[model samples]
Target: MTASDRIWQAQLRAHWAVLSARRDTAGVATSGLGILVGDEAEILAGVDARGDHHLLVPAGGGALVVEDSQAAYIRIQRCVLTIGGRGRTFVDIVCHRADLSELFDDVISSMLTELATDSREQPAVVCKRVLDEWRELLRRRGGLLGEDALRGLFGELVVLERILAASDTYDLSVWHGPDREPHDFRLLGGDLEVKTLGMAGSMVRVHGIEQLEPPDKGDLHLIVVRLVADHDGLALPDLVERIRPKTNDRRAFAAALARAGYSETDAEHYRDRRFMIAQVAALPIGDDFPRIAPSSLVDTLPDEVSALSYNLDLSLLLPKALTDAAITPLFTKGTLS
Candidate 1:
C-alpha cells in the first residue's frame, strides 16, 4: 500500500483541513506543521457535538471504537511531525472523538449524490481522502496476497505504537541511527525482547520464531501480542495459558509447565496447560537477530488492514446507495433481433 491509502489518511485529511482553515484567523501562530492542534478541550467540544461518549481503540487510526451509533465519532490520534534540516518539531493529537451529528447528515447526503453518478467499474478501496498521496499503490485488496500482509503489518504497528503511548506514562523516545534498518533497535540494556507464545483455545502448536533471537544484551525489549482464537475464529477469553511447546528451548517449555503444572522433562509433557487467550507483551529491546526491535515490529508483521470498531463500520459510514452507483450498473436495456 502507498503512503496515504491507510485509514489514517482519511482522518489526516479531515484533521489537516481543520487545522489549515484556522491558519488565517488572528492569534494563530503560523508554525506550519509545527503548530500543534491537539487541545483536548477543543477536541472534546467537537466530539461532544456529535455525541456524548467516545470509545478508545488504541489500534484504531485515530478512529473511534464506540458501541453502534451510541457515540458517533471518528478521531485519529497521532503525532504529526515537521522536520527541517536537522531540527524536529511535532504536533501530538490524542483524539477523543469527532462529533458526527452535523457532519454525518452531510456525509450521508453526498452518498445520495454519488448514487446518481454514472460509473460501471467496481468501487475500489482507494480512500478518496488520500488517493492523491498514495498514487503509487495500485494493488487490488483481496487479489494480491502481499497486500493483506502489508495491511496487517501497518495495522499492528498502529496498534503497538498507540498502546505504548496510551500508557499512564507516555514517551515517544525510541532509538534510530544512520543504518536506517526497519526495526533494528539493538539496545537491550535492561530491557527484555519477547515473542508471542501459544494460542488460547485452538489446537495449533504455538512456538514463536522471533523470540529465538538472541536476547537483548541488557535492557532492550520486544513485545508480542498473541490472540488465541477459538474454532469459529473469535479470540478466546482470558490471557492465561494452559499448554506450552515441547522444545529443547527452556523458555518456551516453561510456559506449558507453568500453565498445566506439568514437569518439563516428561515426554509429551507440553499437553497439560490450556494456553493463552489474547495477550500482548511489549519488548523493550532487540537481540542480535538482524532487525528485531520494537521499531521493526512492522517488518515482522504480515500486511493486512482490518478495522476493530464497535459503533459503526467505516464502510457503512460511506453508504451503500453511493457505492451501488459506482460499482453496479444503474440501467440495463436488452433488445435482440
Candidate 2:
C-alpha cells in the first residue's frame, strides 16, 4: 500500500473507533476524505450506531439503483445524509461483516487514493470504477455529473457539431480535451482551445498558461461558446443523441464519452439541464491576445509558480470575432497558415 493509502486507512479506522465509542449518537460520524462533486461536496467514511462500516459518496439527484447483495458481505444503496445541516444524497456502501472491517478499511483507503488522483471525476463514478477493480461487487453505472461539468460538456459538443459539419476528414479523434490534452481540439492545421460561459457572462476561466499557448508550427485559435439556460432548449442528453448519429465510429465516441465522465445510463438525470448556445466566436490567438503564457512569464516568476489560471474577459475580443466565411478556411485547409 502507498503512503496515501495508509493515511486514509488510519483516518477511517479512527473515525470508526470514535463512532463505536459513542454508539448512541443520532447522526452519522463522518471524516472528510476528498472532494466528490461540486466545491462543497465531498466523500466521507464513517460507522453507524450498529457499527457497520460505510462509505458515503455524493451523487446528483436521481433514482438510486440498489444492487442485490444477498450473497455478498456489503450492501450498496442510495440515501440522504444530513451533512452540515443540508440533506445531501449519497451512495452508501456498507460493510455488514464485523470480522472483515480491516480488509474493508484497506479497500476504502485505496479507493480514497484513487479519488484524490482523479479529483476531476465524480466520486460516485470513481467509486464504481474502484469497485470493479476490486471485483467485490456487481458492476453498476455511476450517477450524473455536476452542473458546471454538464454545461461545459454541452459547450464542447456544440463546437464539435460545428466541426463535424465543416470538415470531411476530421473525425472524433481531433477532440483531445476528453483525453486531458493541453488543448480541446488538435486539427491538422493547428490547435483550437474551447471555453464555455453561461448567462451573459463575458469572462472565461482559463486553466493553466499552456492552454492559450499556440502550437510551435501552426496557428492556435480560441473558441468561446456562450450559453443560456432555457426550458425550450435541448438538454445535454438530447444534444448527445443528436451528435451520436453524426459520428462514423460509434465505439470511439462512446469511449470518449466515458473519458469525459458521462454515462448513457445517467442520461435521465440530465434531462432538465437544457441550454441554448448564444454565441460562438473564434479568435486566432496572437501575441497581443489577452493571456499569460510561458513566453510572458519566463524570467519573471520562478519555476515553482505553476498551475497558473486566470480569467480572460471575452468582451474585449468580441469585436474581433471571425465571420463564418473567415473561419471556414481553418476547417477546410486544417490551419489558417
Candidate 3:
C-alpha cells in the first residue's frame, strides 16, 4: 500500500483500538489529541457514557450538520463527552451501524483535513462553506449540473489563458467570476461575453437581454467558440488545470472556480468527457449588431417581460465577424473611459 493509505489504515486501527478498550466502559474514552506515532494530525475517536460515538478533531472549527433524515454529520465546538474542555471542536460524521462499513477512512480523513485547513475561520462560516461545497458535489454527482455550462466555462478559460499568454499588458485581475457579471470576462479594455456552440449549428444562446447590452462606458465583444464533442479531446478539468498556471493569482482563480459551481473533488467525474474546438469567432457588439437592449426602447413592453433569453443565428453575423488577430487588441490594453 502507498504511504498515505498505510497511514490512514494505522489511524483507523488506532481509533478502533481505543473504542474496543472502552466497549464496556461507562464513560467516553479518547485516543487523545495531537499526531500519533504513525499518523498525520490528531487521531481522535471515542464513545460517550450514553453510548453515542464521537470523532474529535482538536483543530476543527464551525457548526455544520449535513443530514438526510436519519444520518447526520455534525461539526461543533470541542467539549465534554469525548475530549473534554480541549478548546478544540470535534466534527463528527455519524452513521448507522448498518452503514458503518460504507464509512471509509479516507472519507472521514478528508472531512477532518478540510476542517483543519480552515481552522482559523469561525465554526459557522466554515461549516456553511463546507456544506455548500458538499451540496455542489452532490449536485454534480446527480447529473443536475449543466454540461453545456461547463463547456462554456472551459471555452472562456481557453480564451483567458490565450490572452494571458499572448500579452503582458492584458490584466486578468479585472476578469470577473463566471456568470456573476453581465459578461463572461471583464478585461482592462472592456467586457467580453463568451458563448460556446456545440454540435453542428450556427445558433448561439444569449442568456438574457442584458448580456447583449454593453457596459455604460466601455465596449463589449462576443466571443463565439465552436466545439464538437469528441472522445479524445480536452475536458473541463484539463482546461482548468491548463489555465490555473496561467492565472496571475491562484487564490482568485480558485475562488472563481468555486463561484462557477466547480469543486476539485468533482472534477474527476468530467475529466474524460471532452470537446474539440472547431472555430472561434469574436464579434464586436455595435449599433449594427442585431440585439435587444433596455436602452433601445423608450417605453417598457406591455407584458412586463423579464429574464429574456433568445438564440441568435450567427450566420447573420458572419459579415461582422472580426478577424482572429483583431481579438487580441480588444483586450490587450485599457479602454476604460
TM-score quality measure for candidate 2? 0.57
Better model by TM-score, 1 or 3? 3
Clashing pairs in 2: 189-334
lDDT to native, each model? 0.26, 0.74, 0.60
Give stretches of model 1 more than 4 Å off: 1-132, 137-163, 166-194, 197-218, 230-277, 281-337
Judged by whole-model lDDT over C-alpha atoms, candidate 1 comes out at 0.26
The deviation in Å at residue 264 for candidate 1 is: 44
Residue 5 lDDT (model 2)? 70
lDDT of 1 by residue, 232-263 (tens): 43211111121111112222222222222222
Q: Which residue window of length 10 is worst by lDDT in model 3?
A: 95-104
Instruction: Tell me the deviation in Å of residue 100 in model 2.
Output: 38
**What is candidate 3's lDDT per residue for 96-185, written digit by digit as tens?**
242222123434444444455535564334534554544443332234238776877777877787678767875556667443677877
After best superposition, candidate 3 residue 16: deviation in angstroms? 30
Please identify which of the two predictions, 1 or 2, would achieve the higher TM-score against the true structure: 2
Q: TM per model?
A: 0.23, 0.57, 0.58
